[model samples]
Target: MPSHRAAGLVAGLLWLASLWLPAISLAARHADMDLQAFEQNGWWLLTAGWVGIFSGQPAWLANLLVIGLVPTLLMGKQPPWWVSLACAALSLLSLALPGTTIHFDGGPYRVVAFDIGYWLWLLAAQIPALLMLTELNVRRRAK
Candidate 1:
């Protein structure tokens, strides 16, 4: 079994890689009533997404799961099982991002689809917690 630290490091690397890949496809109606679509990657979301909150996009808040996991994963030792479970639960918040409406440049865009980056990010977010849960189960069975 992999150690928590190893799992964390792997997850961290995945999260980093995800930042550069396409995350979401957004569609909005132009002034002429034509629909336009564009893609945004994870880094864009991490940096500029804050402005989205005021524009009725709450999915950005799910980024906090990754933010919160960073310090815990960096710790010297494994956190309690409950901490892992909490992280897992928090990671689920990202699922709500799909179909969400984001107002940008006076136009409302819908999150039409999630791309590779978003899926990778979700996988990365769950890795450490899943590893921790597996470890806990193993230990319990051993005892």
Candidate 2:
């Protein structure tokens, strides 16, 4: 297999593994809130996050977009480099999640920290783009 395809496989595996890891820690703004700090795993977010969109939290869309990377990398002989780059850009939208308030269980919560899963997910989204860029650079140099 080509290096880029190998890299894409690795990325896809990383993303799948990250699904079982904790992605974020959320804290209630009020001291008296029934729930305190809550850790949400990637699987939970990926499976149930569509509700966030209805609740006006579009950042979850970024998480959803990362799925695009899997097929783009695995389905074809080679996808355009720009497609991978676009996936990378969309994956970064999760960065906007930190300061945004989310309504959960009738309470407002803020994301206080990103965990390993989040970083891994971001990395997975980026790997294809990075590899494609390097491949393009190598091709240019061969000219």
Candidate 3:
């Protein structure tokens, strides 16, 4: 078990766990609508094939991508670099896109912030990317 492979396993597990955590937290200016309401409305992390609280189609796609990539990440030894790159790119895109936007009927608006899940997912994606790059460089050097 190489260090990079171990790291990938840990990161991949973290990423899987993150899917259950809140991807985003919401705060509204109006007291009438609070975090609980949004949460109840399904604004938490996606699990069991259900979308996150604020997550839309993109979120589902992101999850599927991660899920699809995690196995490759676990393979570790001589894993395809392209898969890692794709996962990294998808993670970056997911991080950049705002999960969902909720508007209240008031003068003020809602404030949304990235949560633990987002950071963990991003880290998980990067772990494989970095490892694959390093492995490729090491192999090239040896040759």
Candidate 4:
């Protein structure tokens, strides 16, 4: 069996992998819309902040890149509580973002539904925080 730290590290790595997959897809509802709209439209966690179509780079403010991707690169090092909390909070907030809304050129707006990527991103981003809480709980009981 793996130690708690090892398990956490594995979980963190898996979480990071999810960030690289497509985070969203844009689709056009009518023929008047651009056909490219259906293409996978999103950046992985690494470039999620700079790439993609959003107002003022909203992803930078709430992205797994900062929390999930970065920390996972550190290997098995346990992240501080603040880091976990921030990651969890930001990931959750991203879910609330209007990612489905797609703007058109001199046409009506098209809203695309979130694909599996969005849901996976949300779940993966929260792993660190959940692991942190579990660790804290275990430590408390051991005391």
Model 3 earns a TM-score of 0.64
Task: Go through the candidates in order and give the C-alpha RMSD of each one to the true structure.
Answer: 2.8, 2.6, 5.2, 4.5
The residue pairs found clashing in candidate 1 are none
Candidate 4 residue lDDT tens string, 68-117:
44445356566667877776676675554444454544543333555656
Per-model CA lDDT versus the true structure: 0.74, 0.75, 0.58, 0.55
Please report the TM-score between candidate 2 and the true structure.
0.82
What does candidate 1's lDDT look like per residue over 49-83, in tens digits?
Answer: 77766755555554666565655666646656665
Give one digit per residue, the lDDT tens place, for model 2 in 55-115: 6655555554456656656654566666677778767767878876767687788888999
Clashes by residue pair, model 4: none
Model 1 stretches with alpha carbons more than 4 Å out: 51-76
Runs in model 4 lying further than 4 Å from the true structure: 1-16, 29-74, 98-111
Window of ten residues with lowest summed lDDT in model 3 = 35-44
Which candidate model has the greater TM-score, 2 or 4?
2
Q: What is the lDDT of candidate 1?
A: 0.74
